[model samples]
Structure formats: structure tokens, C-alpha cells
Target: MRVDLFDFDLPADRIALRPASPRDSARMLVVRPDGLADRTMLDLADALRPGDCLVFNDTRVIPAQLEGRRGDAKIGATLHKREGPRDWRAFIRNAKRLRDGDSVDFGAGVSAIASDRGEDGSWRLSFDGDEPVELLLERAGRMPLPPYLAGKRPTDARDAEDYQTMFARKAGAVAAPTASLHFTPRLMERLAAAGIGHETLTLHVGAGTFLPVKADDTDDHRMHAEWGRIDAATAERLNAVKARGGRLIAAGTTSLRLLESAARADGTIAPFEGDTAIFITPGYRFRAIDGLVTNFHLPKSTLFMLVSALMGLETMQAVYAHAIAAQYRFYSYGDGSLLLPA
Candidate 1:
């Protein structure tokens, strides 16, 4: 399909710079086959059946954005994937100034050597210290905010807490699973009280999520891989939910992709651990999830394509048109949508 088919006009003012106070106060646009309705995140539990399970991504966002210098050239790095304990694959901002074996000083005693550039143009950066790389990042790195927000303003101390979800535990992701950002402990308690159970999986969201689709056609676009994990116990529980006629609702595209990747042809989810580069487009069959709760996505983005696949392209196009006209916030720090297909 033509990538241009997914394009839509979004006013710049609609981009949210900060989250709604109390998180759950954010508005949610419910998109069902029948019609669209407006609701707050606090009303999420009421939007779904009691037997449904909301799947969340537990991958914690690391401080992966770094600024450094090699000789006189300024360089910026956003670590996307972990290659080893001390090695990470990062997208560089000043590639032409650096080469294989060139060392970059990220300041605050953190430095790394660049090597083995990938076809995507990202470089492998091996940290110099024997100390854990996490510690190095703590001293030198900033939260990797989505470019849409970061380009408008600067990342600050507030982002250290706002960018992460309450379920964050396993630290690896360069980006937060923003859909879960609307969830608060109060919301969790409310959901449990409503008998809407929840579970967690991990998908270390990379900076690739922010990359634009420059391809003219959907077939020409390539998705960068992100590491994810689903253990046996979680898989078994998820399968049991399906068996009992319960719906599995993914709280984010990260969770949705991992669930679909782990789904067998027969639609049972299996234990999985590794990288998934699943590029969900229109005409793709969804086996694992019944619905999705996700943020408003960029025009012509893979995320938009995934949502279009979930609920036909025409439906989502109308949904976005409604969202835009309604003045709903957009992007990572933006409002959300609850999409339930017929």
C-alpha cells in the first residue's frame, strides 16, 4: 500500500508538552466499530468488559540520550539496543565526524569507542569503564524524549519521572511505552475493583520508534528490531484468559507487537525472548489481541499503519479526523485512544 495513504494533517499546537495532572485526567477517545466517544483515562475500566485483561509493557526507560565530543566535533547519541553489558548500538547525530575506533567523551567520566557501523547507520559504542554502563548513563545521560516533544522544548527533571510508567522495572528501553503513562496506582486499583485484570511483558522500546517512514510504499519501509520477553507463566495465564472467553487488550503497541509475535498460528501465545521487528500493516491478521489502548501516532508512521491494520484504514482515518477536530492532545505525552474492532 502507498505510505501516503496514512498521511494526515495535524496542527502543531495539538502536541502535548506535559502530561495531564494525575495522569488519569488525560482524555481518552474510544474508537469502536459502532461509533466514537470521549472519556477520561479514569473511565478506562468502564470502556472494556470485566473479563478483559490489559497487557502493559514493563520495560523501564533508561537515560539513553547523550551528548559528547570527539576532538573538536560535537556528537549526540541515543542508545537504542544493548549489544553487551558495556556495548550499545546508538544512533549518532554527527556520524561524518567519527569513524571506526574513534573514541567519544560523553563527559562526566563517561566515554565510548565507536565501531561496526550498521546498514541503518547506527554505530556500536563500547563504554570504557569497568563500572556498569547504567551507572555511567546516570552520570551523563538524559531521558530520551521523543523528538516531537524534545524538538519543541528541552528535557528536564520532570521528564525523569513523567516519561516512565508505574510498571517500569526491567531497565533497558530507550523510550517509554507511552500508552501506559496514563495509568496510575489509583487507576490500577479501580481497574482491579472493576474485575479488569492486568499483566505485564517487556519490550525495550528503542529510538527507532521516533524514526520517520521515508518510504513511498509500506513495503519499502523497514522496522528496526527491539528486544522483548514473555515468560512461560505469563504466556500460560494469557492463554487461559483466551480459553475462558476473556479479551486480551494490549495497553501499548509495544505490548501488542510482542503479543502478536509470540502468538502461534492457532492463536495461543508462547514464551518468547529475543528481538522482534514485526512490521504490522493493513491486511495483517491479529491473533493475540482483541483490542488496543494507544497514544495518537504520527502521520505515515508504522504505529498508524498498525492501528489501521487493527481497525480498517478508513475507520482510523475517520477516527483521527474526529480526534483532530475535537482538539485532543497528540503524541507521546498526548491523549490516548481505546480501539475495539468489530
Candidate 2:
């Protein structure tokens, strides 16, 4: 399908620069088969049935954005994927200034040698240190905010906490699973009292998520690989939920993509570990998840395409129209939507 088909006009002011206070206070648009309803994140329990399970991504965002210099030349890098204990593949801001085998020095005693530029133009960088790379990042890296937000303002200490979800534990992701940012302890308590179960998996969301789709057609767009994991126990429990006639609702696109990657043709989810570059588009049949709770996405983005595939293209277009007119926020720090197709 033509990528232009997914384009929509969004007022600049509609983009959220910061998240709603008290997390759960953020508005949620419930997209049902028949119509749309405006609600809050707190109403999630009421929107879902007791037998439904909400799948969440627990991958923690790392301070992956780095500003450094090589021989007085300024350079910026955003680490996307871990190639080894000390090696990471990163997208460079001033890539033309550096070359393979060139060493870039990041302040605070952190530095790396660039090598093996990929077909996508990202370079493989191997850090120079005996200490764990995580520690090195702590001293020199900044949170990798989405380019849309970063372009508007600078990242600050508030974003350190705001960008992370309460479920964050296993660290690796460069980008936060923004939809999960709306969850809070109080919300979880309410969900439990309502008998709505929740489970977690890991998908280290990469900086690639912020990349724009420059392709004229959906078929030409390529998705970047991100690491994810699903344990056997979790898989068994998820399968049981389906067997007992319960719906599996993904908390974000990250969780949905990982679930779909692990799903068998028969719709059974199995244990999985490794990278997934799954590109969901319209006409694709979903097997693992029954519904999705996700943030508003960019125009002509792969995420919009994924949602369009989940619901119909026309349905999603209508959904966005309602969201925009209603003044719901947009992008990573924006409001969310609960998509339940009939």
C-alpha cells in the first residue's frame, strides 16, 4: 500500500512535551468496533474484562545518547543494539566525520573505536574499558529521547524518571516503551482488584523506532532488529490464558511485536530469545494478541501501520481523527488508546 495513505495532519501543539502528572491521570481513547469513547488510564480496569491479561514490556531504558569528540571534531551517537559485552551498534549524528577504525573519545573516561558500518549506515562501536559498559554509560551517556521530543527541547533530570515505567528492571533498551509510562502502582492495584491479570516480557526498544519512513511504499520500508525474550513459564501462562478463553492485551507495540514474533502459526506462543525485526503492516493477520494499548504514533510511521493492520486502515484513520479533534496528546510522551476490534 502507498505510505501516503497513512498520512494525517496533526497540529504542532498536540504533541506532548511532557507526560501527564500522576501518570494514570493521562487520558485514554477507547477505540471499539462501533465507536470511540474518551476515558482515562485509570479506567483501563473497567475497559477490560476480568479474564483478560495485559502484556507489558519490562525492558529498561539505558542512557544511550552520547556526545563526544575525535581530534576536536564533535560527534554524537545513540547506541541501538548490543553486539557483545563491550560492543554496540550505534547511529552516528555526524557520521561522515568518522571512519572505520577511528577512535572517538567520549568525556568522563569513556571512548570507543568505530568499525564496520552497516548497510543502514550505523557503525559498530567497541568500547575501551575493563569495567562493565553499563557503568561507563552511567558516567557519560544521556537518555535517548525520541528525536521528535529531543528536537523541541533538551533532555533533563525529570526525563530520567518520566521516561521509565514502574515495571522497568532488565536494562538494555535505548528508547522507552512509551505506552507503559502511563502505568503506576495505584493502577496495578486497581487492575488486581478488578481481576485483570498482567504479565511482562522484554524487548529492548532501539533508537531505530524514532527513524522516519522515507519510503514511498510500505513494501520498501525496513525495520531495525531489537532484542527480546520470553521465558517458558510465561509462555505457558499466556497459552493458558488463551485456552481458558481469556483475551491477551498487549500494553505497547513493543510487547505486541515480541509476542507476534514468538507466536506459532496455530496462535500458540512459545519461549523465545534473540532479535526480531518484525514489520507489521496492513493486510497482516494477528495471531497472538487480542487487543492493544498504545500511544498515539507519528504520521506515516511503522507504528501507525501496525495499528492500521490491527484494526482496519479506515478504522484507524477515524480513530486518529477523533484523537486529534478531542485534543489528546501525541507521540512518546502523549496520551494512549485502547484498540479493541470487533
Best by lDDT: 1
Q: Which lDDT value does model 2 have at 35?
A: 89
Residue-pair clashes per candidate, as listed? 0, 0
Model 2 per-residue lDDT tens digits across residues 224-315 = 99999999999999999999999999999999999999999999999999999999999898999999999999999999999999999999
| Pairs in steric clash, model 1 | none
lDDT of each: 0.96, 0.95
Error of 2 at 117 (Å): 0.8
Candidate 1 per-residue C-alpha lDDT over 1-342 given as tens digits, one digit per residue, 9 for 90 to 100: 999999999999999999989899999999988899999999999998888899999999999999999999999999999999899999999899999999999999999999999999999999997999999999999999999999999999999999999999999999999999999999999999998999999999999999999999999999999999999999999999999999999999999999999999999999999999999999999999999999999899999999999999999999999999999999999999999998
Q: What stretches of model 1 exceed 4 Å from their correct place?
A: none
